[model samples]
Target: MLLTAIAPMTAEAAGEPFDDEAFLFEPKWDGGRLLLHKQGERCEIYTRSGRIVTEKLPELREALADLPVRSVLLDGEGIVLRGGRPVFDDWAYRLRISQAAKIRTARQTHPVVFAAFDVLCTDRPHLEEPLTQRKARLGELLQRGGGILTPTVSVEAQGRRLYELTAAQELEGIVAKRKTSLYIPGRRSSDWIKIKHPRLIDTVILGCRSEPFELVVGLQFRTVKNKPVGRVSKGLTVEDRDRFLQAARELRVRQEGGVQWIEPRLCCRISYRDRSEMHQLEDTEFLAFLWDKQPEECVWPYT
Candidate 1:
């Protein structure tokens, strides 16, 4: 069946397979995946899971109004530029807008750029073709693009090199793909892989909660070893938070200030970009929480 929803694959390989093999790779964007449908006089935006986001972005709808194709389904991400840098948080604001004033505020203050990467459907059906061919056709279809369409490239080695550089430069990571692999929807096959950033650090779990939320473990850590650190709340998703809450009854610890002290045995590795004031604030708004330091798991890139 033709794939719709996309699943990101983890990168376990440190280097490419030694063979001069078949693969095409591109920079794994930090933004979310957006599937667009421009059919005749109608336009709709869908997530990989088929969640419609048509009304969320008026600016995007207006920008693509000039496209030639009456009907087109394209895959891409909405990115925002802040301080001359493309910030994922700026794009995320568009997703979080719930009021007209908020939407207008986003449009006027935080503009978005639709970076189209693939053409799922054109006036002519092209979804059945191999990814290599479809990607080429996508390039041809979006030819009249300015900087709005950030086309993906199919350079495996170059992608790997870029991945290495991104690690050094503290950028996110890259996604690599087998040139011949079919586009499998919501499947994380060997065809696609991600090499994420590698930077590890140990942190202390100061406290955890049970009622306020689930497995929400509050953390406090010193940037430098042996230095006094402030409270840095993080380390749990909504789902995990619930689970942790249930589990907290069996794993209680002493409370200190806003922190709950737990066994400092579960230090996680994390990754993050160099502290940019804009991206930091942007990330906080995107995550709905302030992030003082990168996650511990980010340091140990190899899971």
Candidate 2:
């Protein structure tokens, strides 16, 4: 199946802009991107890459076990509450379980809830419709629903104001989507625009690698001598991981099934919070390097 034929917009790409009067702005949640398809008792949960992750979110599976609709597709984020707020870390804990025991532990330690935003299909297919209509239908479906729906403001000025408010609240950021745009399967048109939290960091892509399981990007910081140091692997979008793998394959540089080497490009931005003393490395005596950035870039907007 063609990638574009399935879903149009991703976190990295924003769609086109609509008329000022017809756009809707929504708060971007600081959680894992998610898509849920349900057919009565059975459910299929997908990541942005179309990877099935239903087993990881058993709590959500149980929550939607007996929905009225026989089949439905919805897009949103899976959020886990932390300190009266929904933090991305909580969601990450729920999504990255590898061991059976770890899965059970995650369930008990950090229960999660699905914060649905868009309904792709409902009895009748609705993805191709304008976002305005889809949102209306979604509102009806969630009239008294338990999950949190992303709050939206149709006015651009109000959208910006809300963005500031959310930012002050320490939330991630806001997504401004054109309300009148059709849901094009895979195009990253200008209809959907994402105004991120301004949490930008420059890092170097010192090296690339293919993990034993998931494809990952390896990165490190540039040392004083201008050499890459502190190599760390993992943490990347499936799209990015796949591209990294493809590049490695073309280079034909697989060493005992480890990561491929890539010269630091000094490109890429990341969002991160300062690590606390509890997270400080034991090898370092002082809590050095308040910010962690890949050697490629050294801009830390979130700090």
Candidate 3:
């Protein structure tokens, strides 16, 4: 079915996933978020950005076509597994494969699977229905041992354990949803909270300090007022450390306390704890230099 407007609902980040009887928790799959729609032998796929990608992943469309429902809209994540863990790096290749022959070859090498999370529109419209009810309907619609798409396995009142397990398994994290929450399309509501493991963030490099033995780098988020929100001095491979030092030197703007303040031109991705009231990212550890993310995109929550 051709949907003129089927914008998927968005989730807001939470400080951490909490265990509550009023919520259901599921592992937040790390990959592209795709909305699958099937109508009377017709199946189509859409990215969260509203791009129509039906022909991109033929396996996904074929899998959805096998469903028994006449009309259904399923929200899911398209993940490619590597060593039993979802990896977005491989998913990038899947998304970039455009040629029909190349797509088939890529699918074989790195197959993508769907983990359905919600049922937006089924036999009847269910968007207005509370998430608790929608989840029940979703389970009924896609039972276990189904095709390529499987409903997201969720836990009730066990968020703390779930988050720990997800982290230990080197997975992304868990998404906690209020049982009574409705699926409000295109809305980033607090009712559905995203509690990612290893809280990864993209920040702009503001400066660096030469500590007694190591180099401590300062990073910030917002560009309007570039205030250092965190410090990262360790957790880098030898190659990364060299690359960082070279970038800092080239982008140097000033010097203070043996610290070379650099222009906010380079961006880096890192894992950090929640920001303190004083606006500092505590326990910040470097993950990788993010050349893909522009410095202008580094906007912290201003919390």
Candidate 4:
């Protein structure tokens, strides 16, 4: 319903970080990925799938309304910065809250900021232009210290160093992309790579999901206290999926959305933002399939 569903450029996963003068690095913010659309006085924010979340995030909507342009589409993230960190759980809770009074209270307590990174359009399309040109234009359109919309910080030819810094701060990760790359919607282009933190943790693959396609992963963490952490659908190559499916039939546990639940016997290492809260891990990635270690060995601080 808005701006022809602006598709943000997607990034491929890289095994490790590297340095190249051709590529620029940006700190990957841990929050909801949003494509904010604003036209005249009407503003709407949508997820990658194009679901309208304008009503859900009133503060972001207000910020967009304050933009200097009459019509624009921006690719960025919506984060609730708490103690200098993006607390995603709080953003998720705010998205579902129904009471007006509660929503107002949360807005005052934890305000949302739109971290604009790319400009898809400003009354006209900029998709044909290279990323470097687009980024400069975006900076001109969005003023610093002027609204909730702050442009994401970028570094040149220092992806590895930036990755190390992000890991040190326990931030999500860093994304590197070619300056000459054009915005290719709905495609994971090689020009862009998402390099995850170096930290790794072992978890068990409990099942296979097929509807939207996911790997049901779990861990016996002390914080979660011996429970299934959550599902991990990204970071598995085609070869990994093929091999996993080969041994899946025999380990079936149950079914939901074509998800072949299996016995928790498979263990693997993965990279993610951080630990689980209450009962699940967020933004998970499958790194490898463990063969030498037992599944119980994948327990939290498991030995």
Candidate 5:
């Protein structure tokens, strides 16, 4: 039961992928990290932040409870698949359902699966064991789960190949984990590195939202024309936020419906996974302010 509350281990970001015989590469699923604790017939699922989410995934809970092991603690992702690929938006939607009836209905219509990547405990703890051993144990323990529960597939010494496969499939990315590394709960360690397929774009700051502090960014066209792409706030540090707000004070043009319009003089770099059908940026994260670049230089085509 204590393992259920344990913070999951985190991975650092790697700029690029490399071939390493000592590393095991696995798909970086775009879903929420979850810990599953099952003892006897009792099963509970917890998010990475330690919030209990068992009520939101009844089908997954039941499937995990039926595992052949006596008691097991699993580290994995909670994903909702569409066309055999994990969709974070759908998985996120499932997490937001609170009403009991709605959750039950969603479980039937929009089911989520637990893709177990690591095994922390089986009858006893195995945190100090090396990752290669833990992975072998994980595969053995998850041999008989239904479709609702599955093991994450991985390749040894083929990080580049796996990364290429993920890119071709348009998956999130690949995780390169050292085979000899031990799981360190709650720590972001270099032993496990995540290589994501993110695209970078430079955009002009069009405005700012007062509440929750988000920057409205757009791609510059002609000197006077702009096309709004999306809003970004994810990667801003406190200092960066303060600096932007201070700069905005002098550039304020007008306030329209809770948004403070600026003079579109500042430019910032953004990292995102892709663009939506409507051309809005998806999974947008603010990288940094482009001081050397002009707003007019952040133009359309993003090249």
Candidate 6:
């Protein structure tokens, strides 16, 4: 069976980090989630969504192919590091390149490191094995640091401390996994929890774009002025898109330059990294529609 057919286990989001002896904490790498399957001398990489990306990352293929094992299935994150921190934008750009010439150039300029965290198979399947056992096997199979393939470092029970360190390092966040949990394919289990450091803001819907579908959001300033912050589309579900569009049609005020202007009555909370000089939200993702929030309540500075 193709490894891509096996969906990687996902983590539930946690609001805050806590000290837990039952859980092992590791850095939540800020890049694409990938699964590598190596059989004999052939290796393939797949995205979380199961798209085969082996061709896009030839260097990773070569590295995995060189592994001493006969066959292994590994779950990891593909990241491009700069100044000791993962640079997601560079990794994202690397995923988009298709031309052979450009890909060769990118391999030299922005090489990606695969941070293996979980082992699904090594000579045989290990899905029923506990996470600790799987990790132990993984460590024995692979080298620890400074390589194209590296192990994801984890602390036994210092979830809070790891979270703090990641925040200080400007890293993505931390993941806490139950030490005895078994890998369940395609499931979002509570055994693993992800704690991210993202600032949340509630913004009123100002307008929307049809093609590809993005929400133009803003904040109310001085009780009357509307300040456009940014456009968001990521994390919107099919239901969310349908519901928002249905409500938007009723609130349609005007259309300008392909944007469907709507009355700023609907509000939603979004997670963002920071704001630009123009005050536009950066790295913004839609969280949820705020049915209880009023447009006036989403004021500037987002207090």
Runs of candidate 4 with Cα error greater than 4 angstroms are: 144-147, 198-227, 230-303
TM-score of each: 0.63, 0.61, 0.70, 0.72, 0.74, 0.72
Give candidate 2 regions above 4 Å deviation: 1-5, 11-19, 148-157, 200-303
- Candidate 4 has its poorest 10 consecutive residues by lDDT at 271-280
In candidate 2, position 246 carries an lDDT of 56
Q: Kindly list the per-residue Cα lDDT of model 5 for residues 120-150, writing each as its tens digit.
A: 8888889999999999998888888887788
Point to the candidate with the largest lDDT.
6
Q: Model 6, which residues run further than 4 Å from truth?
A: 1-4, 144-146, 199-205, 208-215, 218-303
Candidate with top TM-score is 5
Question: What CA RMSD would candidate 3 show?
Answer: 10.0
191-225 per-residue lDDT for model 3 (tens digits): 88888766677788777765532334344433445
Q: Write the per-residue lDDT of candidate 4 for residues 28-73, one digit (tens) a residue.
A: 8867789988888788888877778778788888878877778988
Worst 10 residues of 1 by lDDT: 277-286
Question: Candidate 5 has which clashing residue pairs, if any?
Answer: none
lDDT of 2 by residue, 108-161 (tens): 778777777677787777868888788888777765455543323245435667
- Displacement of the residue 231 alpha carbon in candidate 5, Å: 7.9
Candidate 4's TM-score reads: 0.72
Model 3 stretches astray by more than 4 angstroms: 199-303
Is 3 or 6 the stronger prediction by lDDT?
A: 6
Q: How well does candidate 5 score on lDDT at residue 222?
A: 48
- Ranking of all candidate structures by their TM-score, best first: 5, 4, 6, 3, 1, 2
Which of 2 and 5 is ahead in lDDT? 5
User: What is the Cα-based lDDT of residue 185 in candidate 1?
Assistant: 49
CA lDDT, every model vs. true structure: 0.54, 0.56, 0.77, 0.79, 0.86, 0.86
